[model samples]
Target: MKQARISTGTQDLPMRWWSDAKTPGAMIGGIVSNAFAAIGSNRQRSILTMLGIGIGVAAFIAIVTLSQGATDSFTSKLGFLAQTITVSRARNATNTSLTLSDRDVKILSQLQHVVAVSPTISDEAEVVFGKKHWSTTLSGVSFSYLQMQNVSIGSGAWWSSEEEQSRRHVVVLGTKVVENIFGQTGIDPIGQTVRIGAQLYHVIGVIEPDSLLGNDGIYVPYTAVYTPSKPNQIAQISIQVDGTDNLDTVQTEIQMRLGQLHHIATDGSGGFDVTEAIGQLKQTQQQLGMLSGFMSSIAVISLIVGGIGIMNIMLVSVTERTREIGLRSALGAPPSAIAVQFLLEALALSIISGGLGLGLGLLMGYGLSSLLNVSFIVNTSSFLIAFGVSTAIGVGFGLYPALRASRLDPIIALRSF
Candidate 1:
């Protein structure tokens, strides 16, 4: 007896999938297995395609992580300068004889937005402690210098105001200075006597190693360092403003005041220079941000190239499996099943690529952070976005090829070479 012929129409396609499965889960499993089998057939091409994605991801992650780490480090190291200004002898002044003095400090302190003023007298001196001697910077500062500079005392207390006022021979040592003199002898630095130049000064405190201003110097009363002939001579004056908004105003006021005091014109003829640290910090950060953006743009181009490669490869795959697709369609597989199989292959390729890219990116970030001496940070949002973008690329790029494969006429496909 002759059986009735089955219709291979679009309406009849959804009745079953790639296999004779009785349940939805089992049907899905069979489709997935077939998709992976197709991918496994061309192992070399698959890996090469994924390489583009991996490189793009690694570059993106490393650049962003390094950018953030550098910004954080700079902010921490120089954040204090945002509210401070410094006055020094102008290096480009026509009159090189001009110098700073205590008068500048008092005048700056009386300004409207001024919060604090501390003067510094810096010089290099041979420091001798017991059998060891080292030449380091000797900074003469006021009693308020430590607090103004945000310096922390490591082991001993900062000198008293009275001690500074009386011109006592007491000093605060930097961590480097202590290390050079005391070595690893386990000696208590406080109360130890160290000679600076020819004067014997007792160590009253040790500055924390991370102190920005006093990292490699010694601090003493400004009066103790003063020569009898130049009693008011000072190197620079550091002024703290009440807020960041008033930094420019205070800086201008200081320049005008210094010009008037020195009997010089205010038009770049003044003997002093005024610098806003915040301006320098902003400029540096802006340059860094631009560089990071440029690098990220290149990474984005890499991703686009990788996506194109995926589309090209998937199209080639569809062509290579034309006979198989026709056979499946003739054996009762639907266009939806054929489409799903191709789509799944693309997704599997991309998902695997993304996973590999993630690991490679982290390693690259870590190595870069170490080489650059910055912190290594893993941002969760960035990670999620990377993964999501990869998945989307898979679906978007693979859609056309999948559809073309599904829509093929089984009779035509079967007759083709």
Candidate 2:
């Protein structure tokens, strides 16, 4: 403050400007103006530094957006199915198996909160409909499969309980199968005999497409087409809850019941795995968040590098403008003004780069969302993260250089030229 005082004998550009100023606003305004002037004078160097940060931020947004979209894709179709829980063989390094039997399905169905339980089995078989031979996946399930899955029948109907009880050779065709085999001429496939493997089965219904339930699979009777190759290789069980309020309780009950039925020790992981859509969705969200943070950190490292570049450039600016700095100090420009001027220059550079990075990142994120077929979200968090990082980088990297600029000895600086 003392150093900024006019010598009381000289009137110059900065001295005259400050001598009449009633408030600190004028000084602050001058500092900002000078900072902009300096940045504009070194366009190439500033642009290159900005490029470093912009590239990093863009990559960060791209990675997060793409990964988040992938997770969204995983949960989108099954999101409404959150009320349903599935029991399947444990997928792990130990390769644990679940031996689900009729008794287990019965137990699940009899639970107070359980609505319906559908046991599913899958097998690949060759189908022939009047010499139009095609190989298709055959899914075997209980009579309640369509009801539990919430899938609709397009034509005819799910087999009657009498048909299922008598082990009748009834099958259901997916709409795609109907189109492919029947040439999509609106031919009715009901009551037609389709040869599956060595036997011909009656197609009793066709599955209609419902976005809510996703694509219903080609279905057949458990006794008709699919047989377990391994002795106890029972397929998955889909359990629909009567309501969502007690979903957790229902899941816990199922786990406990299955554990007791399998005679597995309660101290370890269950031999069977129960999968809930909401639970998986939450897990996927957490995993994506972690992955986004980890990957974004790697990309944000470039901003640190850009900050170093700004500091180096500011130090060089001070060195190159030593005479200007000395003249300004001699004319009563405060050391605080010099420091703030340099800091402002760094801040300006960062803000410009940060904005550029933000725009590029949005563009990249939009492209990723389109490519991955998910929602594009550019909310306040993105702006805050970017600008916050920029401001921090400016303050952190510009401090030492600003101090050096402010502390320069006027006489020595004047003599440097």
Candidate 3:
């Protein structure tokens, strides 16, 4: 009797293949089918690995986005606080001492492109309101100071030049000072008398809380505390230049005028220090850019690590599926087809993780902005770069493992399992 023969049709086998001249759709379908098959074989592991990539990418995006937003908000607040030229006495200068006098401010006011000049004098002192006492910065400034600093009186009016000339003691309190001294009680602190270092000052206004500068301050009229005969009178002078003119020329002219008034060297380095508010704004912006870049680098590191994790998992996948690869090779599936299938799977994982990460990152950024009372500024460039990098990482790291799978000897790979 002849030995019984068992036959299984090629179609009944676990793996299948198509002809070489197959249509484009069929080729693509085969790639997709293989990727889904791989994922389905180890659904939990694949999902867990992709989750790791998603988390890393999300963290990177959140940190960079938040940092950029915070930097922008901080710079904006600072810009608002200092909107014009700020001339202060430089603590150090070669030759004569750099001091800005009230006379210098008067001269600057008469110059072309000079909008307004405001002088300030400040000292730290204890303020007493009724039985309450608080430590505060006592600032004496001219009427134009409020306009120059863009400060607004939230409740009452600011002190006038007449009040300053008459030496009438009136004070403007910062929001925190008002809150700390008066609490939430319905009693109006305005029109109330407050004593500062043995002098009596009536509360004229309350300024809203400044976002950049911390609170606990009071503003008094410049003339209320100045003595013309006293040499060391004013602390600093703020000058507003014509917004229409060339700022460089205006700054140069202002410096030259200050040099002439103070009798110092005029080679751009005068006795008094002149700080252009616009220059400060630019510097702040540059610093913010650097900070954003640094934070973005940290995010990139996390993404790279996540990509490496994907590569390692893919290598393990190729090893585990060697028998399947060998079976497919035996069925006339080309090595390039095998490689494309694995590469497509890797790309799919990376693209999906990147998208999820970006969404989560944006959500986290908005959440942080809400919590911190700042704005959410999503950088489109950053999002695109992140997604591109993730995809590149997938292709770059996935290639070796995929090629290794495709190059496996069918006979050996089949027998090894």
Query: Which predicted model would earn the best lDDT?
Result: 1
Task: Report the lDDT tens digits of candidate 3 across residue range 145-213.
Answer: 777776667888898878877888999888888887787555698999988898898998988765232
Error of 3 at 315 (Å): 0.6
Residue range with the least summed lDDT across 10 consecutive positions in model 2 = 5-14
Candidate 1's displacement at residue 370, Å, is 7.1
Q: In model 2, where do residues sit more than 4 Å from their true spots? A: 1-22, 67-76, 80-82, 88-99, 102-104, 129-136, 142-194, 201-217, 221-223, 226-233, 243-283
Better of 1 and 3 by lDDT: 1
- Tens-place lDDT per residue, model 1, 129-224, is 888887898888888787677778888988877987788999988888889889776898899998888799999999887777656888898878
Writing each residue's lDDT as its tens digit, candidate 2 over 1-417 gives 532432212112234334555678876776676677678777888898888777876786677666666667656655557788888766651534557776787788998888777777777877778867667777878888777666677778888667776789998887667767776446678988988888889989888754233343467776564344554545788888877787988888887787688777452244777878668767867888888778888878888888888899888888877777787787677898888888998888888888888889889988879976677766676678788888888888889999999999999877765
lDDT of 2 at 394: 85
Question: Which pairs clash in the backbone of model 3?
Answer: 98-271
In Å, residue 302's CA in model 1 sits off its true spot by 5.0
**Clashes, model 3:** 1
Point out where model 3 deviates above 4 Å.
1-22, 80-83, 94-98, 210-213, 229-231, 266-270
Error of 1 at 343 (Å): 4.0
Cα lDDT over the full model 3? 0.75
Locate the minimum summed-lDDT window of 10 residues in model 1.
6-15
Give the Å error, residue 40, model 1.
4.6
